[model samples]
Target chain A: MKELERVGLPTVHVCTIVPISQTVGANRIVPSVAIPHPLGDPTKPLEEEKAIRRRLLLKALEALQADIEEQTIFGN
Target chain B: MTYRVVHYINQFFAGIGGEERADYPPELREGVVGPGQALQAALGEEAVVVATLVCGDDYFAEHAEEAVDKIIGLLESYRPDALVAGPAFNAGRYGMACGALCDAVSKKLCIPVVTAMYPENPAVEIYRKDLYIVETSDSARGMRDAIPKMARLILKQLNGEPLGRPEEEGYIERGIRVNIFRDRIGAERAVDMLIKKLKGEDFATEYPMPSFDRVPPAPAIQNIREAKIALVTSGGIVPKGNPDRIEASSATKYGEYSIAGLENLTPETHETVHGGYDPTYANDDPDRVLPLDVARELEKEGAFGSLHDKYYATVGNGTPVAYAKKFGEEIAKKLKEADVDGVILTST
Candidate 1:
């Protein structure tokens, strides 16, 4: 991500709930609820999971399109 | 025989007051405050807390240079042999203030500085290298243990003795790199390790692992509506039946699947065979792993010019750093060819 960013390509990261990426310097991050299933709760109904995934994904896309000067957190 | 020491504390710890007193500018007072007594007691007769300075967290953060200058001015008169700040524990702002102070003191005064905080504190990365940082619990409950370690490190600096590793000294790992002479070759050690592995014998690793220095975040994209965005992942989602046959683990290759006019990813058309873990969820409905449904929705919302017709995928677990870099560059080239202005990379 850093390399791509250096070359002038915009990049937003979708990461797990873990805080590791925040420390490693990902400026735009959207936190997935868990490690194995980042977009939705695996235990929920398939349709319900799909709804959650769509919301988070839209937020992530919005984050990429938005202008930011410093590190920004998107959907938590 | 006495070694003079300088103590740094926030307004609350300095005994000036609480949140209301947080604006208390940097003031130097002779003698110790609360924890300074415990620190002095631990330092014994060899070290004395000669001067103490207190400032508010908000004030210091808002006026870092002014605070540092004021504190440095006060320290010039005392010239302590060492500086010790907070065992800030879980207080984010206080921990950061202590780190900032330690870094400033070491750079300006050219004296050893030490402090302690929990590993989770955000300040660990800020000043771990500028000073000796002893690891402490989330609260002051471990002060008895943390202070003794700080005192020992301070004493070592005063006596010019070699400082040991964090594990040996019971301090927090400062994440500083130092070269040390080793007794044997890593290859030979690896062979021996392999032999031990075959024999199931316990053996120490010859080459210790290095720490990771994370890069700072990059600036965000300016225009989503005008930008052509691409989707990338290490989740290993690919065309049905794994057409590209990308490896499930330690992948040496990556695959890109087209979604030119696709509104959703059905299991019949897309599936994930990543071997890192069970792919039951991803295989049932590829949209669970790849957000094509959402991407199409956003496209309708005019959030971007268009999601790239194709999205890139790879299995990241255990993939060598070199290969991962190569794969990223290759995929980036593809995206560039398609005039992608930005990327949203999903990691699983």
Candidate 2:
């Protein structure tokens, strides 16, 4: 978060809900599926869930590569 | 000359009511309520709270256009010298509403729109440049203290006075860069600075180093089969029983914990103690914050040769800039020793 960015760690964050909580210190943010299960809801069948998880994982990777200022949220 | 000031507030602050009163649409009233009263008192005869507008959080968030239109219509008639809103403290919804309104008014009417909030409030980043935001306490208890500071800033804006630093002015640091002139001649100062540098005396840099804008893309892996990747984070993820004990805010240290043979983060094994959010979910399942699960999947897919056995972790909250840079350099040195080709970092 703030400490990491302050120390110049080149960090990015991913969360299922709005990470307003993290923005004070975080350099970047990527929206995820949910709080308890960020990759995908475990209630769904494993195969369907993995597909969603894979997609979000790719989005998180993209967030790390993207240059940003202040705080930015990826994946809308 | 008397300057007219328009005050903006949420339903509760406007005295129109709370959640129940939130449905109340935007309307203009004369004078002030809540912190606006303190603003009026502080600004004194120089400024008058000519109008007050109130709207519900749900109303503004859901029906932004309609609410803004109504509020703007009211403001247009008042023709205020400046607009002031909440030192919203830590209320996210209200802080956002204040930021939105201030941005709109400043852009549309070309009037100075000012508000305040706690540094922790998310609105500081969203609207710090668009408005004059003074830092306040996390609750209304800071009203008496926050209001006077905000009013003083508004007064300075009205008088066309140059603003001092955030610390001096009691505002949240906007991190805006501005060229400032010194009273002393530049040539003399330059010579003095050079002498200090040669003598190894600590001299403040005349020009602060520009922030690095373009990070070189991690060189494309020449061979994914042989390249090693590392997991790093500022998300405050750590092992159970809080072994490393990283400081929560303004962390001076970082920890690199061994994750050998761990395919995934489990609630029982890993936890997050970061103060920024409710760690209930992330603590119960560290992968939600660290994404070790995703890293394992990437390893299985042969995206890289191997995941480094140990991953670096730290608390990113309120960390100072100088220390962060040093930490990154140190971590980079470690990565080099381990032949780490790339890093996939996650944050909360």
Candidate 3:
């Protein structure tokens, strides 16, 4: 994500560990739900997981489009 | 038998004129001078200051190589057991001179070298790994405390005693990792640390995470609705047969798979090879990690311009930061060539 951002490409990191993402210096970050299934929670039903993934991806898109001078975590 | 020691200091510390005398050439004098008196007293009977080398900060800075060579030549005749440089505090030039002189003496003279400076001194970052630098206060006020630590550390070197950890020894961390046998396995240790953390007790991490360079954010996509987006992942998602053979841990290479005309990642088409986490959920539906299905939904909904046909993937598990950075740069180059306007990078 930092590399992409370096080359003038807007990037958002969807990560389970926000601190790790911050330390790695990602410009934009969206917190994922879990390590095993970052986009979809395993315990949730298939439809629910897809809905959660959609919500998270939407948040990621929001991050990519937002202007930020420093590292910013969207949706905590 | 007393161990012979050599001390190095800047002109100001040698009681020479401050700033105006900063151009004084390197000079060697017998016995302790200035702060060396305190350092010698700290050494007690175990060590004796046999010589002092004083150089102007400007002269050393301007002619570092020559100054170090001259200083080394002057000290070689004394054949001191160890060399000690200044407790330079926050003075940048003096701190650098001390650090450089110590480093040169340790290398060329092949003897133990010790220096002292404030932790925040720029020289600390440059020389901490190569030299033992006792932490000092930001100014000369730290002299009283710094000399003893510097003396003790040098004495440890002279006696060939094993050094303690940086915190225990009052020195800056060298950023070196040493392998040691522990009574408990890593899992048990982690659990113990977690419990301590939960109880709000202080517990040092076995491995401190390395910090990375921060890049200023690029401008936001002005028209994300008309942007060309790409997906990149460190979740180790790949084709059914693992054609690239990327390592499950410490991935050396990244794969760019064609997602062209694909609606979503199915178990028949994709699986995750990442070893850091349980792969069950991702194996069941690779989209759980990559989110191609939702991305397609958004694309069809005209939420963005379009998704790039190729998505990059690599395993983040235990990957060395250097390789990860290289892969990121290469992948970014490809994405740029493909005119990708934005990226959504997922990591496990």
| Model 3 Cα lDDT, one tens digit per residue, B1-348 | 899999999999899989999999999999999999999899999999999999999999999999999998899899898999998999999999999999988888889999999988999989998999999999999899999999999999999999998988999999877788889999999999999999999999988867678889989988988999999999999999899999999889999999999999999999999989999999999998999999999999988999999999999999988898899899989999999999999998
Candidate 1, B288-346: lDDT as tens digits: 66778877887888867788888888887788767877886777677777888888887
Q: What stretches of model 3 exceed 4 Å from their correct place?
A: A1-10, A22-28, A41-52, A67-76, B15-27, B55-71, B162-165, B175-220, B237-273, B279-286, B292-297, B306-314, B318-341
Specify the poorest-scoring 10-residue window by lDDT in model 3 chain B. Answer: B206-215
RMSD of 1: 14.2
Q: What C-alpha RMSD separates each model from the true structure?
A: 14.2, 19.0, 5.1
Q: What do the candidate models score in CA lDDT, each in turn? A: 0.80, 0.74, 0.92
lDDT of 1 by residue, A1-76 (tens): 6555655667778878446556555678888856556776778997898789877877887776667777778865
Question: In model 2, which regions exceed 4 Å deviation?
Answer: A1-76, B179-348
As for lDDT, the candidate ahead, 2 or 3, is: 3
Instruction: Identify the candidate with maximal DockQ.
Output: 3
Report the candidate with higher DockQ, 1 versus 2: 1
Taking the tens digit of each residue's C-alpha lDDT, what string does model 2 give over B1-348?
A: 989998888888877677887777777888776667778899989989988887887788778877777788889988898988887899888898888898888888888778989987988878886678999999999999888888888889888998998878998767687787889999999999999999999897656643433332232345555656677877788888778788878888889899999988887888876766667767756776676776788888975578889988887678876687678778877777787765656555
Superposed Cα deviation of residue B24, candidate 1 (Å): 2.0
Ranking of models by lDDT = 3, 1, 2
Best by TM-score: 3
Reported per model, the fraction of native interface contacts reproduced equals 0.51, 0.10, 0.90
A best-first ranking of the candidates according to their TM-score comes to: 3, 1, 2
